[model samples]
Target: MFKIMIVEDDPKIREIVLENITKWGFDGLGVEDFSEVFNTFIKYEPHLILMDINLPSFDGFYWCNKIREVSKVPIIFVSSRNTNMDIIMAVNMGGDDFIQKPFSLEVLMAKMNAILRRTYSYTSVESNIIEHNGAALNLKDSTIIYNEHKLELTKNEFKIIYLLMKNNGGVVSRDKIMRSLWEDESFVDDNTLTVNINRLRKKLADIGLDNFIQTKKGQGYIIL
Candidate 1:
């Protein structure tokens, strides 16, 4: 099943979209921690993202720009603020489609399916094996390889590590990281991210990848 990320703030809307997505045979993930949108995005690496315009802390446009920097993933804007300016801004921010709220779920699914087919379904994955140094990530199977030692990762863990490796040698901002983790960046607790990162680091160390990840004080992390 294709994985999809939903970034709506309203519980009802989030559920509605997820239901439709699931009905279309796509696995859906709703952002639990809005405060860490980018982190969740990378951690989950959803095939497509559904975003709301008006969000706490930073809006959808802000998060969209962040995601665009790391991946060519498709983003569909879903918002109640359906002004011409908003729609135009959504496109300018790299959204593939603008979906105004109070719309039919069927139409939404259609748009989503079309985007997925054009962007990924018609194209094979990039060998699924994303490698660096002695470490490699099997995108096809979602696995990791390091020094001939295999490491099985949860979907969240794999996405986190993949984004870090993709942006190696550069400090990826915390906001950027959060977006990958959760759709609503306003709801994520700082401790939650800390715990996940700490756990990932420990796992890497277990595989002899000590210090493979470096932290920049007040910034984010990088794979140096």
Candidate 2:
């Protein structure tokens, strides 16, 4: 089933939306730890998201920008803020659509269905091997081949490597990385990500790819 992640903070709205969406026959995931909205998203691997504008620590715009960094998951902003500027900014910040609060259930369901169809209706299957800089990632086999060396990878490892390699020479921030690793559950603590990344790097080192992924200090990580 195609999953949809909802990031609304208000429990009433969150519950209502979840009920409405599920009643429409699509699976829906409610964000538990508001702090790890993106993290939950990566784990759920949702096909779309329903985001609220005002959040506890960060606004939906900030989260939307973060999600756009590594994914094109369809985001539909759902907020009580109904200014034209708010809607415009939502769109500019990578929201695919915006639904104002006090909206009809039918309208919300319609928008959800439309966005899902539009996003996935045209997605083609990825090729087994994606290559660059003499490196090849076999999607079918979950391995990275480079310089006649084959580096085996777990699914998460392959995805992390795929994202970094795809955005070669560019820093992929921890927020983005954590989203990829644990988008399904509660917040992914910083130390948790640190541990996984360290483990992933050691695995790469085992396969002779020492320092293939570099730390970016106050920023994120990169494949340099």
| C-alpha lDDT values of all predictions | 0.80, 0.79
Per-residue lDDT tens digits for candidate 2, residues 83-179, read 9999999999999998888888889888988887887788842334555555566666687755445677887788788888878689998888778
Estimate, for each residue in 96-214, the C-alpha lDDT of model 1 and write its tens digit: 99988888888988898899889986685343445565566666556665654567887778778888877756788778877898898679997777788889889988988888878
Off by over 4 Å in 2: 124-224
Number of the top candidate by lDDT? 1
Superposed by TM-score, candidate 1 places the C-alpha of residue 123 at a distance from the truth, in angstroms, of 1.7
Query: Which pairs clash in model 2?
Result: 39-183, 40-183, 41-183, 42-183, 43-183, 43-184, 44-184
- How high a TM-score does candidate 2 get? 0.59
